[model samples]
Target: MENKNLVDDCLFCKIIRGEVPSYTVFENDDVKAFLDISQVNPGHTLMIPKKHITNLFDYTKEDVQRYLQYIPEIANAIKKAFPNVTGMNITTNNGKSANQVVMHSHIHFIPRFKGDGLKLMTRNNADQYDEAKYNEVADKIKAQF
Candidate 1:
């Protein structure tokens, strides 16, 4: 049974409706932020718009504005929740190709400490550098600045 009122079985919608359970931290009229079941660290959190959208790229201007309006407070909540955190990283996964398991627009705030589990490595190879592409990317980013 497809419940049109529920955005076609959205996990976040079920969470908001209390039809499912989650370790939620904050919620308002238009947004909600919750603890990740698979925590990347002590304060890894997922924030989302109350309304359904496949991802951030698909949000309307109103939805975008509404979601951003609440971010600072939500971030502050994370800061308080993870009192020992040294730094924070905010990220969003867009599509299945981008690793988004749930079809909802969400921002993840992952806090990090010195020598924590968020280490990264890069392969040094021919695919790592491209000169023509670098200039084009810099030109595009410069325009934004």
Candidate 2:
């Protein structure tokens, strides 16, 4: 049976179906891990679900469980494959505003070393939030539950 979630023209879906070439590192029935063509680092990798869900907001409960289950194992394999890797960043961009180029949901495993020149985030407004602001934000998110 066809997986209704698979998008016909999605890049990651093409990679998943072997219609596009990729430097695939690992793959199973549920997910595929491959080298990011735009190597932010030497061992930069992308782990994506076989299903073509757009982003985290679209994942079902079972999708989350199956997708996350392979992260630890794949991360360890990446670390082991690269002896110089000191640390790692596992990130997923949720939408176009979040820098998601492709529509498929993917987790990035970026290996980090001291002074790799990659700046993942900056704290420009570290002191902007006070207790009241913090509580207001927290309460808004908590109310959703």
Candidate 3:
């Protein structure tokens, strides 16, 4: 059953409704998995909830739990479908500052190989970090929680 509360102009919502074509991998009551059109790598896949959600912060506890519960299963299936996938990166960006182009929340499963030339992360100004700075940052975050 399609979600009736989908956003009118959300691209992912359109894909979910079959208004746009997608290489679907899996679908269940609350989520859907499909191949990413850009293919960050050959086996790059995107998983999203059936209900339209703007970002991680917008999800309720139950929504977060239900949406994420299918990740391990879908990730393992992707690994099996793609040969020589020694490692994988599962990532989701939140707001615009984080480079989240689509408003809808979605997780990307990117298959990795030895020397695939894809750098998931990079060190920046590591030597500039001091213990006091780290403690201050941690304290601020903990205060909010």
Candidate 4:
């Protein structure tokens, strides 16, 4: 059996280990999603890679393929369950530095509406520098690729 978490005592790992229970939404060979009991919004859901990586950057190619495959279906299921929902936000936090409470590779499908708990995060644009600066940065990134 898998060790489940990168380190033992991980709550999400316990869920995978069946040492604890979660209100699961979907489970397949490589992924699992469950209802967020502490729902940010109704039907709030969480999905995770079955392997014991801590975040997205650690996912192997096969792990990534399997992880991506379930996202659309998971999103569709949540949307279907709450037809009144206006929009959806899929978010993942990477590290403790990023405020990721659980040290496991997981994504969240947070439902959004006109006014709700999920809308707590505000969006703001970063200041755009001159066009020359933008082009220089973009060119450097393109070169790296």
TM-score of each: 0.80, 0.94, 0.93, 0.84
lDDT of each: 0.80, 0.91, 0.91, 0.82
Our model 1 lands, by Cα RMSD against the true structure, at 4.0
Candidate 3 lDDT, tens digit per residue, 1-145? 6568698899999988999999999998789899998998887999999999998999999998889999999989989988789899999999999889999999999999877899877578858889999899899999997
**Each candidate: RMSD to true structure?**
4.0, 1.4, 1.4, 2.4
Q: Which 10 residues in a row give candidate 3 its minimum summed lDDT?
A: 120-129
Clashing residue pairs in candidate 3, if any?
none
**Residues 35-98, candidate 4, lDDT per residue (tens digit)?**
9877888988999776778888787788778777888899988989988888899988899977
- Candidate 2, 25-133: lDDT as tens digits: 9999899999999999988999999888899999889999988799999999999998889999999999988899998999999999878999888567748989999
Best by TM-score: 2
Tell me model 3's lDDT, rounded to 2 decimals. 0.91
Report the lDDT of model 3 for residue 102.
90
What TM-score, to 2 decimals, does candidate 3 have?
0.93
Candidate 2 versus truth, CA RMSD in Å, comes to 1.4
| Evaluation by lDDT, superior candidate among 2 and 3 | 2
Worst 10 residues of 1 by lDDT: 1-10
| Candidate 4 steric clashes | 0
- Per-candidate count of clashing residue pairs (backbone under 3 Å): 0, 0, 0, 0
Q: Which scores greater on lDDT, model 1 or model 3?
A: 3
In model 1, the runs with Cα more than 4 Å from the true position are: 1-5, 120-131, 135-145
RMSD in angstroms between candidate 4 and the native structure over all alpha carbons: 2.4
* Model 4 ranges off by over 4 Å: 1-7, 120-126
TM-score of 2: 0.94
